[model samples]
Target chain A: MEDQKPTSILVLDDEPIVCKRLKSALEKRGYEVEIFFRSSDAFKRITERNFDIVITDLKMEGLDGMAFLTEVKKRSPATEVIVITGFATMETAKESFQKGVFDFLAKPFKLGEIQDAVERAEKKIKGNIS
Target chain B: MRILVALDTNRYSQYVVNEVAKLAMNTWADVTLLGVESRKPASNGTQPPRNLPIVRKLQEFREEFLGYFKDESVSPYAIKRWGYELVDRGKGLLEEMCVCKGMKDFRVRIRFGQPTKQILTEAVEEQSDLIVVGCSKGEQCTWEQDRNAPEKIVKAAPCSVLVVKEEKKPTKIVCCLDHDSVSQESLELINQMVTLHQTDLALVGLTESEHLREEVDQKMKQILQYYTAQKIKAWVSVVDVSLLDKFIADTAEKGLIALWMGHKSLIGKFFSQDRVGKLVRSAQSSVLILR
Candidate 1:
């Protein structure tokens, strides 16, 4: 029964389609996912509950991905943060690694790409939790 | 096969020489030692002495260097040349020496030039399958300060460059995957490197949302499928944040890890720095970060 506990993931993105698509896709694969449309909402929930992985879009209206990543690390240092963004730059990529982001994803990303990220996260989580 | 150990008469050069000898012993390839003298102007401008004493000392140093390899069965030759201006001349001399020895299968030519360009050009011209270079400690002299040589060689060389900083064997390799779109290429490269080095492969996926597990799974399947098709020997495991420490520990076992990150995934400014630095510093294994 303990082994059957669903891998919990937190998805933070403003886009409804992205969240819904990921949520549905992840749920089908036996993972429990929580979605947040706003960075603040995601931050609040993160403080309230533990997540194995956190995937967030880099660009948002307020409390952008980096800031969200910082808060995530502050609150749940164990949770691995992966940032997804459409605009890719070398400086930002370096910064993500410096900030200890587990991985970086570019926008317009394929479902398979997101899945790959989740798989890596899941592996990390399993190693930690079990 | 012949290997060239570019000797610079420095401590770093000794390590390069030792590693090359070990590799030669393992591969049974002949070794060549090349000593290059750059005629760049001295900052002091006193026409720094090129006295006969200095020449005699260099010759003695060369002989002493060759003495280290005397016990080994490898046929060794030494050549000394002066100045970047005479690079073509030096190469010609090396070519003549190789022909004279009647050893055509493999030849190692070690010479000092602008370390990066000379190595790359000679590797291509010599059709070397592998180029091994020692990382400079940079403490004693500023000669090898540019660690960028490895990166530059990777970009330009026709063959693979084995950049050796310390004597270490890779036990774990981290393959950074974005999706199946580029996974095949990434996996193929990873598989070749792992098999060549006899190392384990760790698959790392970065997700933007928690709900992307299915997508990630499918991609992993694709990667594994390709590896299976190729019949490459590797241990594949998926890692997420929760199990990162365990993954790190498992990878740290051999104290050497290679991280394969596709350049495409490096898109955008927000996530770049953190991603690069995290993998660079945290892992216990020596990192081979591939672009």
Candidate 2:
């Protein structure tokens, strides 16, 4: 199968550095990457149906990663969600997994690890869409 | 992309630094130059001593390696302030060299403990996209008492690990479709790297016997056609098991070799251990074992 278009990725992080780093890395890999520092802005973009994958930081000021993912999945079940949390606990990890999150990574994770998770999630999206 | 480079007292680590500098500049990636020193007892168990002298080995290598590098901006202000020996020097040199190469998002991190453990831990904490580590000549390339640091990191790292034997620009990106499956994961990963590097693609198919040749050839065509549909053209070759080693070495010289990785893979298991360590080390370019 051929994807005529590039994969669209939405990255949400409270930390600007995290968003910028992920944007550059994923952009280099040919994904159209957009970064958002505010959860409200990210939530708006998700409802607009722009991105194929949503990578959100678990801990945020307004909307936390879990609630954000849950809301995204409810409206757009096909959209893949990958949650990254710096303060990962067993309970939160389980909750995200049960919520059908594509993958949950503990913070200070490797960029490669996140990339791999995104690729795996992309396959699921392709399967769902096709 | 978050890229962590592990610099040590070895001269080869300089090559890793240069390679990272050029790569980070081209990719606009965030770079972290990490130097891990052996955990030694602080004479007072409190503050470190001032006026840290440069490690003789690190100094010697820097002079020799930098002699060819025309960048005069590679200074060690942090090292002069931190008051440590070789490792602090490594951290400063790597950061300075990256800055000289026009990289803006670069930082130096120094840790005192087991090098492999600290490097791996940092890769996790920083969420690095890639880990570039340099191994010394022979098997002596280790962190503290940890044996096979290179191989261990290659296996244990959560992200992709690029083991640099010597610094050279990649001419081609090689992807071996030797697995029984359609290689969906491997192909997807390779596609990303290929897009980023814009290097030539060489797909190698391994057939155990003559009867398997037709199937491998057919799969090769399918993969090639898939790429073609995506507007990416690639060359394909079918090889017997006996010629696999030579095939890898020959392909590695161009740029990168992407070998399918798993515990069961003959190729991955071979290169991930000491059995084929020399083969990988001697390759002309960098090695990326996709897991």
Candidate 3:
């Protein structure tokens, strides 16, 4: 028998409230979570270590979410990236899906919605491994 | 925060609901969906029938608004069922209605009278923090019956008002700050708008004279610092008080124009009531009158 490693998630949004709430909610659900308010910092951390899942915002200050997620996929194809944005459009959603994003959620969404997204992502991650 | 959404049976009103839903969900504000019908009640003061076209349309609007929050297992503003009571005040039949209760209030109401007067009265009675309304796009923002309803609400609202023109998304929010008396609530509202649009923030401060540049700069710096701390991409510039009007007109075409006209705000003094109404009608983009 071997000890199992908990699922690790990295959440990035320029809005501190979004980051904080995601971190708290995800942690409560038995997941290890780290949050960043800057895309640059999140990118640096991503380059350092790969996480099981990544949740990001489309619009950010220095480096936008789309570019950051592309780099994440380039490094680790298995890591699922879920995008949550305040300014959502059909074009952005299509582009995100084309880039192989796991899920897309709009801002002002209830906590339950993200949790469901995370659960679905987890199932897909587990399926790929099995 | 309480939000009063004044709607008419038009395409303009249909689009405004989505905008209001975004704001309401973010702020968790108590919301009231108001519909005004330009009809006269009977002389006997009898209540209007429940199946009037306007009432049915209002119910449809309510459903559309609630659709935005449907996926959640436990809704924040939970609604049970539609309920209404007909109360006849002096003016006409005022239907005070609600669809049950939740942590926050979501109500659908109907009024019979003039559009502008009814909307204004609802704002005052609900003690709403903001009013969200829409008008036609182009040179004139005409309602179904009233042509200048949106402009009148912006000019006479006791609280802040958001006039949504076209469904165009703003690339930036240009907040014109003329004084240091901006309220924290107003700033938070601007932050929400910036986040909603995923746009940059441009702060324009007013300077009366060459020597006043330093003072205005200092004030702008303070406000700029606040947004910076919030991790919002923001910048500031000082405009001569004389050129403020021209600056706003130029910027309004591209971004949302947010004017902080609090009670003690100098911007209120600069832009008179008539001027405020004119700005609301003439701006190419949407306008946010922060009171």
Candidate 4:
């Protein structure tokens, strides 16, 4: 507690309920969480500060999630971003990799799956794995 | 939920922080401590000059400071230096309040600009679920005559805003429901906060006259039925417009006031935004406005 740095997560999804449920779940697991239902707001946040991990949904109204991934990687290359979407395709997944996504999870995925991806990202942050 | 707790230099500011810590402990919510640094000089001009230390330090380490940044562009280095100092000062203040045991894993954000604008931008950036702004009882008189920044932020906030008026151990939450605008989504939120606070939930419906009593009655009954089935012990009441102030005051003595966000017209003909604003200002207890 005295020396360890806190890991913070930012979740961006158009669905308010998705942000809400994910936030509560992550917080309960001893992770700091922030949620944005809009990409524009998320972009502002990314400019102001950096988060340890970012979980974003691909399909959105304005400033699509794929564009967000690009912007985030450009701003902070080391920051890990995971893509989650209902409509997943090889093309989108390949593009996400090209933009530097840590992991890609499909929509209707379980909280357990997110936690697993986050754990892997945490290991990467700790320099335990690449 | 990701919650942002904004602090000021007010006497009661720490109380707000402590109360929020207690809330996080119960609900498993992480908090972001935000402090705004205004360029304006202190009103009383009693404190020591702020530029002394940084300027004096720069003089002593002029060679080292210049050497470190010698390779960087002159323009960007100067901007980073100033921004770093300001942000560092803001972090010092926020860190003082993060001493609580529950705040061990908190995040600090320091913004140098207008308080409302900074807060709104941070809230939007964080996509925060709640923004908890603290106000003292003594400052109410001054803010009542004019719409304060907190009031303005509440109106335009993209998420729910909780205005904690003073230090009060809330025993119940008086949820003011607009019969015309009540929806399942809002009710679900009301349920979450009520559960988070571990406080009793009471629904109060405002009506102007008996002409629409039957309609109001049916709506109240439906709300009660839904909440009851959810296993939440809830109560409902119908009150006239004239008695709203008294009802609010009575509730404030031992509980918080919960209201939903909606267009002013959707709040039934009897209630108005002005009255809601007044309720937030004058309430002795904290007010949680759900969006």
How high is the CA lDDT of each candidate model?
0.55, 0.65, 0.77, 0.66
Candidate 3 global TM-score: 0.61
Query: Docking quality tier of candidate 2?
Result: incorrect
User: Per-residue lDDT for B1-291 in model 2, tens only?
Assistant: 567887776566777877665443233345677766666445564354322221444444444433433432321111211222333333345222222322123566666677778889998888776788876544455433454577677767766677776776677787665554453334544554665466678887766753345555787787788677545669886667667678876776666877655434355322334434554445555677655
Model 1, C-alpha of B13: deviation from truth (Å): 4.9
lDDT of 3 by residue, A1-130 (tens): 1127788999999878778988999999999999999898999999899999999998787899999989999999999998887655545655776788877665545576678779878877887887
Best by lDDT: 3
Q: Which candidate comes out best when scored by TM-score? A: 3
Residue-wise C-alpha lDDT for candidate 3, range B1-291, written one tens digit per residue:
568999987787877888898766555556899988788545444566676777888889899988877844334466433456554555665767553545357898988889999999998877777899987666677786688999888878887889887676888998876655676557767766886687999997776763345555676787888777667888787677788668877887788889877753244355667777777777766789987
Candidate 2 — which residues are off by over 4 angstroms?
Answer: A1-130, B41-105, B136-147, B180-198, B211-226, B262-278, B281-285
What's chain A's TM-score in each predicted model?
0.91, 0.93, 0.96, 0.93
Supply fnat for every model shown. 0.00, 0.04, 0.02, 0.00
Model 2 scores a TM of 0.52
Could you tell me which residue pairs clash in candidate 3? none
In candidate 2 the C-alpha lDDT for residue B220 amounts to: 77
> Candidate 1 residues B158-190, lDDT tens each?
543344445555666666444444422234334
lDDT of 3 at A9: 97
Question: Which regions of candidate 4 fall more than 4 Å away from where they truly are?
Answer: A1-130, B40-105, B138-147, B182-189, B211-222, B263-271
